[model samples]
Target: MAMVCEGLVVDLRKLEELSCLEGRGMASHYYPPCPEADRTFGLIDHTDPGILTVLVQDNIGGLQVKSLRDECWVDVKPIPGALVVNVGDLL
Candidate 1:
């Protein structure tokens, strides 16, 4: 995850004293099919609250990323055997 924050001010490179290994966790989510897909959202638009997030998308992808270049929420089309690395607020 620290690699995701490379060149940033809060780069977490030297974490020998931070007990980072003991403070780690993981999660999984499942979203059932929504009949009204346009009107509903499994998760609302939000920023990552952690240092970094490694996301593995399935074939039925619905991921989106806020594009800084265009200043828009762009749909992230998933590719097979790929991972999305999200840099978060905590850096």
Candidate 2:
């Protein structure tokens, strides 16, 4: 299970904690920082670790998913009355 927010402040300590205690540092993985080439549109990414993912956005469209190697970022522009789903690593 997980909680998500595009601009909400987070306390990492509140995470379910999949690993042992470790000092804080830049996360190797991230929901790509506000794309340098993207702004003034709407969103850039939507991510969270949960059994399933749900997104609710305004008219502003910009949600995207990055490709492997990050050579490109695919725009997953949101659509009305649609739900994008993903499977979590419940392993």
Off by over 4 Å in 1: 1-13, 18-22
Give lDDT tens digits, candidate 2, residues 5-87: 21234544334465422433332322433556445354445554443445554344456776888658887776755656654
Best candidate according to TM-score: 1
Deviation of model 2 at 62, angstroms: 2.3
Clashing pairs in 2: none
lDDT of 1 by residue, 1-91 (tens): 4653345545465443354445776777767667788897556779987666888877777888889898898888989569898876664
Error of 1 at 2 (Å): 6.7
Candidate 2, residue 10: Cα displacement in angstroms equals 35
- Model 2 scores a TM of 0.38
